[model samples]
Target: MAVDKVFDAIVVGAGHNGLAAAVELASRGWKVCVLEAKSTAGGAVNTQELTLPGFRHDVCAMNLSSFAGSPFYARHKDALARHGLAFVPAEHCFASVFRDQSWLGVSADLDTTVQRIRAVSEKDAHAWQAMLADFQIKAPHLFAVLGAPMPSWKLARSAWRSWRELGKEGVAELLQLLLATPRDFLDRHFESESLKAMMAAWGLHVDFAPDTAGGALFPYLESMANQAFGMVIGQGGADTIITAMTGLLQELGGQLQLDAPVCRIEQDKGHAKAVVLADGRRLQARKAIIANLNPQLVFGRLLDAQSVPAKYQKKVDEFRPGLGTMMLHLALDSLPDWTAGAELQRFAYVHLAPDLAMMSRVYAEAASGLLPAEPVLVVGQPTALDPGRAPQGSHVLWVQVRVLPARVCGDALGRIAAGDWSQIKQDYAQRVLDVLEAYAPGLRGKILASLVMSPQDLEQFNPSLIGGDNLSGSHHLDQNFFFRPVASYSRYNTPVKGLYLCGASTWPGAGTGAGSGFMLATMLAA
Candidate 1:
């Protein structure tokens, strides 16, 4: 590649969204170049053997269900599959172990799930069936609202279609459901505290705690979707999709430059022209420059002060990152023998969040800059469904501790005096292990090797995860929907004429859905 090569578009980051955007444009006859700072692509979708060789762990994301069902995958599934993409399905979706040594899990088989629910509350069993039936009617409407561009005509059309299909009364009911908190929503539907806790764990996957408004949607969507579609992970690792996408991009005449860190976006009179690399190499963009980055970096660091408007800069500065998440990857001799039940080993994720009250406490503690005494752990047992992720009989544990402070101030349990993550990550990792040990006895003994990634470590690895917020920015009602990143700039376009933003920071927010990238491509290509 020539030093002064001018492509039709230059993608700033080679995250999944950036790759999706680059591939989409290249397929439409646009010459694209994707520059990634990291040696590897995929960003949060990356997979690495952090624990040991042959023990492949998804460094950030584990589940690929959202990516599998995304519009981008739907459009290019054949190509991706041809490029060595595959998935391993798990019939058992997720489960939660209670302090009472009891657990509740959701399975693809409706009867199996109902039986588990009936063990706790027969009434809740009936409620579970009703919600699944209701989900059939609501999923399409809800997906329409979520799939369309925020604050666009497509979005208005989706709302109108929902009105026509759901009618006035149905639409009113849907609005109430969207505004309700997880606790409130669960209270109306289920009686078993354990059952509610099992479903509510899905909310914490983003930034929503039990009481967070607009939190009900994720719990409802994930629970119902998992029951309907089951869950699927990459065949070997989560990076399969990334590898496939990049391969397809190259085949389509798109260029990917790894370890090419963009220092800043060069602009001329409010028009983004090129990106200057950290090594002082400039690659010009003939038409557009798309930044798949945190909004703060795109505005606060990349674009020069004179190029960005003062008001726009203020909005980016005020953008709130979600509570940080810590990653714990372990190469285990075998899966834990759960005290709740051995059946837990069959599920993809086992959440160690006993109840809604605990969820609320964890959120409050992290929000107050205090290290949570008992952090909610999302224990991902990928080997249960995909043995190829590790050597035969061995397993990899992907434990994500959610809702930790970005910058610690104090310890909720008063056990650790150090506030810095460097000094306290190991101590905090042990606390998470203790939490798991309560549900899965002798869990610690199975560990052959372990790798702990603090919030700081994640941010250093990938800058988009500012403060290690995997969702990139908070998904609260005020910061999400049409108000994401900025109120008026929800459609990927920025104040600069040819510079656009994509990735987790844009509307439709986090997860591996690739909605922001695909949507942005459609707009630009049109």
Candidate 2:
């Protein structure tokens, strides 16, 4: 195909956020074009038949919680709904199983979650309710902070007003909640080790140590609140959200070119001029260029060295990629019979973290480039919530083991590709299966087929996920807010004029596709 005419804007990477930016800009009368390296539009939000002929497995992300609170969902609900988008809430958000065979199920209902806690520790149950109550009081303000760009005058003013409204003591308590680690906070509130472990495991969802600085248990609570309000699965799976965004972009006259890997972002007169595709096609843009990729790939590989500010370059080099994950997608011939429920219950967000000490050890091992002796596994059976995902009477199970170390030192990728999982994947997968078998005994026999995607597979599939670091960048205190991606370019705008970032790598870090697209849209529209 010949190079098209210049577009008002060119979005590199057709991820959800990229498509979102294109849709917003195009809706405002800007001629937009989206370029994707992959064959499909959704970057990580892909669905494929990896397990069986008819089973539709969500390749990467399964939860739509992060995207739920996004402006993309709110502003375009009708369009999304028209594209077959649907959400099914999990009965219990998650269940944490301990080594002693005890478990805690975190329900969607706040009172039910507290009751689950009460089954373990009565005092802790009351404490959980108090925590929820306190957070509810401040949830609106917190949501405002998350919704908008950070370091804004508005955010500061809101913070000041909150301080005044809540009083000095309340402000102090809130600060403590933000700074304390999940383990510390849970230990202080709950006496039972299982209860503490159950709550603390939520912290691991992001790529941070439980004891990492500026770590807090509030992140877990905040995520739960976000889910409670509207964490629905896209009708056909997670990819449905991405498909809706893409459809909207197309409807608004935006163009999308897939299988076009961008090799470099061309610049002229200190401004972004165009992007050079691997096929030697230079697609030019008139107004701006947005990158929906990780900072390392965007700065280190895409942009020329001279175009980036020296300080920003240094920070990009130092910015750590968060945790790595190993995912197992299974196609079961029949549903696993469980005492909890005969039909796969939405309450089956299962966790295999034994205790706080064990969870801590898991992180320590992952950081040291060694697989955890006993890893934590999180499982979700979306097929239970939506049966259309698989063949009749069959099911699909999505299992993920977070905080796995990227086998960087050795030829781990080669070994894994060669079917040798370095004993890590083997041991971890078996452990997860053992947990499943015990809870749902016939689960092992019901497995018709399974596919495992190592961290290497993630990187290969989406180069933006450097070393399988899904968050784009770490969510550590040093890398968040003003320091996100880099301090000088925190507002989605880069030092290179007219070039902006619209991906998970920007502020708010990962999981939620909140910051990049909306921030870029607001800035460009202004």
Q: For every model shown, what is its TM-score relative to the native structure? A: 0.98, 0.92
The whole-model C-alpha lDDT of candidate 1 against the native structure comes to 0.92
Sliding window of 10 residues with minimal summed lDDT for model 1 = 299-308
Report the lDDT tens digits of candidate 2 across residue range 419-444: 23544466457766776776678788
TM-score for candidate 1, residues paired by index: 0.98
lDDT score, candidate 2? 0.75
- Compared to the true structure, candidate 2 yields what TM-score? 0.92
Q: Which residue pairs come into collision in candidate 2?
A: 86-235
lDDT of each: 0.92, 0.75
